[model samples]
Target: MTDTFKHHLELLIACVIYGTVGIYMQQLEDMSIGSIIFYRIFFGLTALLFYLSITRNLGQLALKRKKKYLLLLGILYVLQMFSYYSAIR
Candidate 1:
């Protein structure tokens, strides 16, 4: 089906982008590893927020229902990233 083909194409492109992150990171050795990780998170968060806003999905997120869990999850993500960045460096 055409839908399956598009799904595969999307996965392929995601793979390419993920693969390219290594090359991009390799080019940024002069920057502090924290800076690199911060920039990555900042840009990714900004883009994700923008996409959600443009699609008017933020209003549908029901954050009030999961505020505590979401907050904990976010903290966990940051902590995990700190360790991951250290390992990557």
Candidate 2:
């Protein structure tokens, strides 16, 4: 496939996944929102690490500079996810 075609396909798949998140969240209403968020992040992180390892890019995560900025970004991401899930609940 052409690069543009491949990119569009990926975006479409992502949109479908995004649209289904609320449905899945509703099905998991018995679980605490925090637990649901934790599982989502954990599974996402696991998939990312698996992909990076498979592509031999795991070492790219090691940064000698801007470590503080990375930490800040991570904190912001968790907060954003927490708020998003809370709102969904």
Candidate 3:
């Protein structure tokens, strides 16, 4: 597959994984919703960071990206996560 095609395929797989999270997460007991959210974010961040580093995209991303957009993205991510956590709780 082409690089762009592979990227799209990966995104599709990610959507499937996320689609199951709610069902899978609900099966676990004795765990707080905060813990679930923390684990998801912590592991997801690590995986993305590792993928970027492996692809040598970290440096490229830093050089090519604007700081303002990163800040905005971060804010949006946090808000999305807060909403997800609220719904889960």
Candidate that would win on TM-score = 2
Please provide, for model 2 over 32-86, each residue's C-alpha lDDT reduced to its tens digit, 9 standing for 90 to 100. Answer: 8778878988999999999999999999888989989999998998898788878
Give lDDT tens digits, candidate 1, residues 1-89: 69999999999999898667657766887987778768888999899889999998987656668788889998898887667656665
Scored by CA lDDT, what does every candidate get?
0.80, 0.89, 0.78
In model 2, the runs with Cα more than 4 Å from the true position are none
- Cα lDDT of candidate 2 equals 0.89
TM-score (all chains, Cα) for each model: 0.68, 0.81, 0.61
Q: Clashing residue pairs, candidate 3?
A: none
Candidate 1 residue-wise lDDT at 71: 91
Tens-digit lDDT track for model 3 on 1-89? 89999999999999998777678766855777657767877998899999999998886555465888888988788778768756765
Backbone clashes in model 1, listed as residue pairs: none
Could you tally the backbone clashes for each prediction?
0, 0, 0
Candidate 1 lDDT score relative to the true structure = 0.80
Error of 1 at 54 (Å): 2.0
Give the candidate order by descending TM-score: 2, 1, 3
Q: What is the lDDT of residue 19 in candidate 3?
A: 76
